[model samples]
Target: MTEINENALAKMREVVPESQIHYLTKAVSRDDKNKLGCEQKNGRNVSADGIFCGGYHPKSFHVAYWGHADLTARLLEADPEWNWEPLSVDDRGLPAFDQNGGLWMRLTVGGVTRLGYGDSQGKTGPNAIKEAIGDGLRNAAMRFGAGLELWSKSDLRSTQETDDAREWLVEAQAAADVPAIREIWQQARAAGADVDTLDKITILAQERMEGGA
Candidate 1:
């Protein structure tokens, strides 16, 4: 697990629009089926779930681009001039697929290009090709810092303290002994609580103390 930096997330929100982040933030449990029998528009999506679906995808980034027009759609939506070229080619100058049914896609945006690899071997038939192309491009874009927050899953994004943190706050508040509560603040500061966090702790503790009183 990696540490989540508070400032970095705010930066990602600016660089990548929330419209794109929402898809990356989505999660479906193994038994959840609201999306069952529905295919993404244009097959452009790069889902967190693999072709067949099972466990949820990593929540750090858009797990999958949905729809058939995925790679093209993302580029056009962001920068109309964006397009992709196959990094690997056959003798006929066509896009090439490897033995594992993977392809590398090179995406050029505003004249700059990036190469990303895709694997849709798990999928069968024609759509496999489309999926590979989209996934490869998405993977490459992420490398460009397109979705830096995707580097950390949703759980890691929040600045709000955890249940444990809140528990400590509440416990300290309820403590009748001053030294006991002081110890809580000390522990919290050592754990890297920010000024705002300490303020919140004080406020929460006061409310608890007052309520008990």
Candidate 2:
């Protein structure tokens, strides 16, 4: 694990300049191995959650990759110029050396970066896999949007919660019940719906009733 993290970091340092480089390491915790720290509203792992990065703003862009040690070796072999410091393990036995910990690397890039995590064992070097993950994330980000806005946990969670709203809307639409819509609008109002989002929902409801999509 140490080898992989080191290799991945090294590759990143090599790919980017030292002036642009930033290294994040955990501060160590009692339950790092057993459970994840509390998830932040921004989707970052807080110290309480067992995630430690050197320094990062909640809105900062990050590129993460997870893979086996062999991938690290391949990355270093492919790019000997890269360099990195080895992070030490904590008491829970979570370090680069422990297989259970897996290899983790995060980098900040000007543009969107790619990311991927493999579930099965593969022949590719961990470094290559990480590189590919970075590439994939970058590509996806480019097609839609960029920046750390996509990294917001609260917003993403809110959107996920909308899935329930959407389902309810579908059911209501099928029934074409104005009373049902009124009930929902009242509920939304009581809940203190954000003016902007509520306005959009209102438009949707209006369109649906008007036989327009």
Which candidate ranks first by lDDT, i.e. highest?
1
- The segments of candidate 2 whose C-alpha lies over 4 angstroms from its true place after superposition are 1-159, 189-201, 204-213
Q: Per-residue alpha-carbon lDDT of model 1 for 21-41, expressed as tens digits?
A: 334334322222334322343
TM-score of 1: 0.43
lDDT of 2 by residue, 1-213 (tens): 123334333343333222332333332222224333334543433332223344442212222332224334434454444332214446775423225323332322322223322222332566654544444333333222232232354356457546745654555455455556666665644443333434555666777678743
Backbone clashes (count) for model 1? 19
After the best TM-score superposition of candidate 1, give how far the Cα of residue 24 lies from its true spot, in angstroms: 8.8
Score residue 137 of candidate 1 by CA lDDT: 71
- For model 2, the run of ten residues with the poorest summed lDDT: 111-120
Candidate 1 error regions (>4 Å): 1-14, 21-74, 154-213
